[model samples]
Structures are given as C-alpha cells and as structure tokens.
Target: MTEHRIITIGREFGSGGHEIGNLLATRLDIPLYDNNLIRMVAEKLDIREETARAVDETTLNSFLAGFIFEPIEESSRLNGTEYVPPLTQQVYELQCDIIRKLAERGPCIIVGRCADFVLRDHKNCINVFICADWEDRVERIAAKYDISQRKAADKIKKMDRERRNYYESHTGQEWGSIDSHHMLLNVSRLGMDRTVDILERICR
Candidate 1:
C-alpha cells in the first residue's frame, strides 16, 4: 500500500489558493479542508461560525499589551464575556486539533490558517505556498466578486494583513516567506492548471 501524503497550502490573499486547493483535492481524490475547519471549530466550541472565523489563528495587540508574563493557566477559561483573554487562544487550539485529526484520517489538502506550521512534524507533509503578482491578484479578486478594482485592492490589503498578522503571531514566522514552505508557486505566471500539475508532480 502507498503511504498517505498530507498537503498543507499557505496562500496569499486574492491569489487563487482556495480554488487551486479545491482542484488539487478533486484531482487527487482526497478531502479538501479550508472553510470546513472553521465550521468544525465553531461547532466544537459552540460559538458562532462567523466569530470563530474572525479569530481563527489571529491575535490582538490588546490581548498582549503590557504583560511580561503569560497568564496563569487557571485564569484561562472560555467565559461568555467580551473581555475574555482566552477566547482567541481557545479557538486557535481547536483549529489545530481539527487539523491534526483531519491529517490522521488520511491524505488531505489543507488550505490557510497556518496548517503548514501546525502539521510540520508529520513525516509525509508537503508544505506549499501560493502567491501571485499584485495586479493579477487584484484583477482576479475583482472578477470573482464582481467588485470594482479599487474595492478588490482594498479587500486584498485588509485580508492579507489579517492573515499575515495571525501567522506571525502563532508560527513566529513571516507568512508568504519562502522559508516556511517547501515549494512556492507564482500562480499568475504559471496559471492555475499548470501550477496544479507542477504541484502534483512535486507532491507525488
């Protein structure tokens, strides 16, 4: 029997990362995890999916303000309060747990939320980072969402900032940096199909 391979994809905003992940999953006949992980965390924690998605792997400067020491473990509980210091942390842990459980199930493709860092220790893991030119990304986003170019640019900037900040906070590494990935693809130049083909060869 062949060994199972886990592919973890880290992508930049406005890039066709999610679409490529879906295509790869279909081609490889494996489960694809992107939005579903957020749902699972929300269900497990009994929080709204929107809320879970909002804090997924993200940290706030306010939460880290003026604390030279980490909080006592005993004080960390998921209370139904707006000021809870542990809410985001709990969500992040839940997401990580879900990612681990998914990997254990079989070969799968995981997109975003720093799955590469979470499953780095897995022996058969393939870490891929997807990026594209700013103009190409902006155009893609605009076309996909039927938004103006300016709107697409704004959305891309905000989303990338959130993703970058979240990744840096959790993984202690820069998001979209070459060092974090085994392979980096420029989807704008290679296009989606060719990129997928290259990744299939690399992962195989």
Candidate 2:
C-alpha cells in the first residue's frame, strides 16, 4: 500500500529473509539496510568493522562485558570516571538512531536489528517475520557458507539464539511472535521468488 513507507524484516537464520529484503528493495527502487549498518557504525565510532560486527544483533551478559572493549568515545566521555553501558548496548543505541534517520529519509527495507520495534511508533511501517523448515535452513546455510550440514545447523542455532536474545532484550518482546509482526511468511514453503512477489505486492 502507499502507506507502507518502511518495511522491517525479522527472520530466522538461513531463512532467506535478507534475500527477500534485497529483492523487494530492488523491485521497489528503495534502499536496503542490513550488514551495511555495521560499516556505518564502525565508521561513526572509528572502530574496526569486525569490532562493530561482533556485537551486531548480539548482546553481552554482565559476565561477558569484561571482555568487550568500550568505544573510544564512550570511554573518554567523562575522563574515564562515568558508567558506560556495554559496547553491545552502545551499538544498539547507535543502530536505533540510524534506523530512525533512515526511516525518516524515505521508504526502505531494513533487515533485522529489531527495526520493527525501533519504529513501533511510525505509522507507515510494515513488519514481517520470516521462517523456514529446519532442513531447508540447514541446507541453505551449508550451501551459503560452504560448511557441512552439521556445522550449518550449529551456526543457525547460535545465530538464532543471539538474535532472539538481542531482540527480546531491546524490545521486551518475542523475536518472531505472530502478534509482534504484521505478517508472517514461510520462505521455504512459498519459495524465494513467490515470497518476493508477495512482499512486493504488499509494498505496493
């Protein structure tokens, strides 16, 4: 619909959610934000992209916080005498700001980073959750990363856990719950092209 100015996709690992976002963005002539946010955050904080990406869509428990290096800006803000949140929290805050700005700029496809919750008050946004069969996910991940199915399954489990924790921590809501999203699609069931076609139609 014309009112759909922003689309946020929440997906399971290896579910083809990112691919759908890419296809939809291209078909609609809009911007797509995903891993590129890591680059932006890294540049903004003057940190290594790997450093930024390590915390992306992941959280640090108190026990793990001891190992994370605080952003230079955060450390120097109060002459090293103030309490700064964990690097993961700071990254999440920065991402929220970036997501808001991008949404304000124009229509775009934002994949993950809890963009659906971040833009909860934006009237022109549509949030979609994507899932796939376990075997399908395993196969997709294995092919994508050139890893064995067992390794792919392990990676999927880890990533899904991190994403779920990150989303729940920041938004205080379940990551892929039906009530949290406007639409839920099974990419493995519908196939990539058909899923993209449905989303493109929805955006129109």
Off by over 4 Å in 1: 1-3, 60-85
In terms of lDDT, the poorest run of 10 residues in model 2 is 62-71
lDDT of candidate 1 at residue 91, scale 0 to 100 = 69
The TM-score of predicted model 2 comes to 0.90
Runs in model 2 lying further than 4 Å from the true structure: 1-4, 60-81
The C-alpha RMSD of each candidate to the native structure, in angstroms, is: 5.0, 3.0
Best by lDDT: 2
TM values, all candidates:
0.86, 0.90
